[model samples]
Target: MTPETVIGFARSAIEITLLLSLPMLAVSLVVGVVLSVLQAATQIQEMTLTFVPKLVAMFIAIILAFPWLMDKMVGFTRDILLNLPKYIQ
Candidate 1:
């Protein structure tokens, strides 16, 4: 493949990765911020306090978003597979 094609593929891969990860990351970030605020307000300050909630929230988010995530990944894989001949040429 040409340099432009290579770069385009790289960019697409990175974009897909970010798109797939953003939801979970955003959820975790929001949960962490909220937990921090609660801890501050309640003066709990327990190190493990945030872990369970964040884990649970992330797990829930993943479960909720699994279908969409799978669709995106499958589509990406299909596109790459279908375009394999073009890359080979």
Candidate 2:
């Protein structure tokens, strides 16, 4: 494949990765911030206090987003497959 095509593939890969991870990351970030604020307000400074909620939120986010994530990944895979001939040439 040409350099431009390679770069484009890499760029798309990164974008897909970001898209797939966005919901989970966002959930974790929001959870962390909210927990931090709560901890500050309540003055309960425990490390796991932050971790457990973030984990659960992230897990829930992933579960909720899983179908969309699968669709995106499948679409990307199809696109790559459909473009395989072009890359080969």
Candidate 3:
């Protein structure tokens, strides 16, 4: 493959990675911020208070988004596999 093709594939791989990670990351971020605010307000600064909720929220988010995430991953893998010959040439 040409340098340009290699770069394009690398760029696409990065983009796909970022796209797949954004939802869970965003959910975690929001949950963390909200938990922070709650801790600040209530003066309940327990470590588990923060850890448990964020973990649960992230777990729920992953469960809810599993289908879409799987679809994107499968599609990307299928595209790469199907086009393997083109890349090999």
Candidate 4:
């Protein structure tokens, strides 16, 4: 593995990681923001108010996105495995 090959592997890993996490992260962010706004409006400043909803939303997001996530992960793994011989050189 040359430096460029190593870098390429690192970049692909990072990209796949970010892509896989994006759905849950986005869901959590949107839920948190909406909860924050609602809290502000109702003047209910409970610190724990946002946790449950965000957790649920993120869980739903992961559930809904699981197939797609698995597909991406499998493809990345396949590609990496397929390229292993080339990388070994």
Identify the leading candidate in terms of lDDT: 1
Q: Each prediction's TM-score against the native?
A: 0.97, 0.97, 0.95, 0.97
Query: In each prediction, how many residue pairs overlap at the backbone (N, C-alpha, C within less than 3 A)?
Result: 0, 0, 0, 0
Location of the lowest summed lDDT over 10 successive residues in candidate 1: 45-54
Candidate 4 lowest-lDDT run of ten:
46-55
User: What is the model-wide C-alpha lDDT for candidate 3?
Assistant: 0.94
lDDT of 2 by residue, 5-28 (tens): 999999999999999989998998
Residues forming the 10-long window of minimal summed lDDT in candidate 3: 50-59
* lDDT (0 to 1) per candidate: 0.96, 0.94, 0.94, 0.93
Clashing pairs in 1: none
Residues 15-54, model 1: lDDT tens digits: 9999999989999999999999999999998978999999
- Our model 3 lands, by Cα RMSD against the true structure, at 0.8
RMSD (Å) per prediction: 0.6, 0.6, 0.8, 0.6
In model 2, the worst 10-residue window by lDDT is: 51-60
Q: Cα deviation of 21 in candidate 1 (Å)?
A: 0.4
